[model samples]
Target: MKIKKEFPSIKVNKEDQTIDVKSESNVGKKESKGKVGSEDMQNYFEQLNEIKKRVVHLQKIVRRFLKHVHVTEFRWKSVIGINDAALTGIICGSAWAIKGSCIALLDQNLKLKIRPEIEVIPSFFHAESKTNLTCILSFRMGHAMGAAIRLLTYWRGSKRTLVNKPQPLESKS
Candidate 1:
């Protein structure tokens, strides 16, 4: 009685075994009229549909982003000349291998990963004295946003699971 007096919002109905809190929005609504099982099934389906819609939408956005994620409008290039043939050869070999590096590294896990693309443009020796090189690496903003969203979702889900218990609409009557 004291608790009810203190918290009028709490509706402890012991008859139907449902404890629903009263809000201004649901004050006059028939939230407790239907059979509990039927209502629960309906709500479960509604929630499932909502989740499916959101997940599909998220998937579409992610795929579209993966296609045009990198902005080619702005490109950074570095041109250098190495005097030593051995050093130049080593650098060229490394660049060649790395240029072919693809998203195969992270795509298997989430199919939701991004790898920055690098292009190496090598030029023949001007006078056989120096090897000219143009190396470009382009990264996209979408990768950061995708990573942030993934981390936040993982954190929210784990936190909710570890810290909260399944409460029956405030307190089960």
Candidate 2:
């Protein structure tokens, strides 16, 4: 469909094939202009729409990244053999700082089992103010253990089977 546009000054000459489009000289025309074209408003809306789309895409990526981070962090903490209490403390701290909540150390079996041993150690030896050799060693071992556990777990997939308990022998008749 051919779209016909109307102009204030231009008249279409029907006699000839060539239409003479005219321009009324506003060359020295006094500006009685108040508000002009709505083009600016349309452009602003388009720009805002583009920005909204980008923001949504960025939010999606951030959500996915956070999910992976929380899962990996919780898994590593469990493997490191830190007691549930310590792990809980760490996760709580992380949650306070970051957006997503961390998984509780008590929720995992390994953290629940090992945390008692960590807690049993004397606080004087591993005081936060002073770093003793035992504390240093323990921290290093914990980090390494956590990393190793994470890799092992990843390799093993979802279900991990540890040592099988021995079956009790039946009494002879």
Candidate 3:
């Protein structure tokens, strides 16, 4: 009891404060970390997947466009009327065959329903069985022509189609 002590015990006084500051600080840090860590990772992965899907979709669209272009170009170059009358005849004949196949599968019940929309079908189909056959043949011919155009060509839209029409040659002086 006689010697005086040089060091004293440090006391943290908390009586004046309403809340514990240390606990509050720790909670804030944890919340901030949670937002930047797992949450950001989740969002990043989602965005990456979305971009991949979009790229694939765009690739398919581009491929289809290219195919259509090729078809249009081929039609312009090789088709008759659209190029030679002989080619047109062949295309119509093929379309007729396809039409026959479609009619065979569809039968009379379905044919009656579709008849109104098909105005160009031949009326001479006397046989119940032959009606669908004839209709199918007609449809096939048309479809063949479309397929030919698609396979053989590309067009620069309606303007190109208009400009390509038949024109008479003028004599020079």
lDDT of 3 by residue, 46-158 (tens): 65555334343444443443333311110001111224445545654655666566545444312233332221222232211112112221123444466545533443233
**Which one is best on TM-score?**
1
Tell me, what's the RMSD of every candidate? 24.4, 33.7, 36.9
lDDT of candidate 2 over 45-163, digit per residue (tens): 66555534434344444333333331111122111123455764565455333322222432231222232211112122232321111111112344545544544444332433333
Candidate 2 wrongly placed segments (more than 4 Å): 1-54, 66-101, 105-122, 125-173
For lDDT, the strongest prediction is 1
Clashing pairs in 2: 83-115
- State which candidate, 2 or 3, has the greater TM-score: 3
Q: On TM-score, who's better, 1 or 2?
A: 1
lDDT tens per residue, model 1, 53-154: 434355554555456443223222323336665666776667656544433433432333233444444433531322222222244666758754653463
Error of model 1, residue 127, in angstroms: 15
Clashes of 1: 0
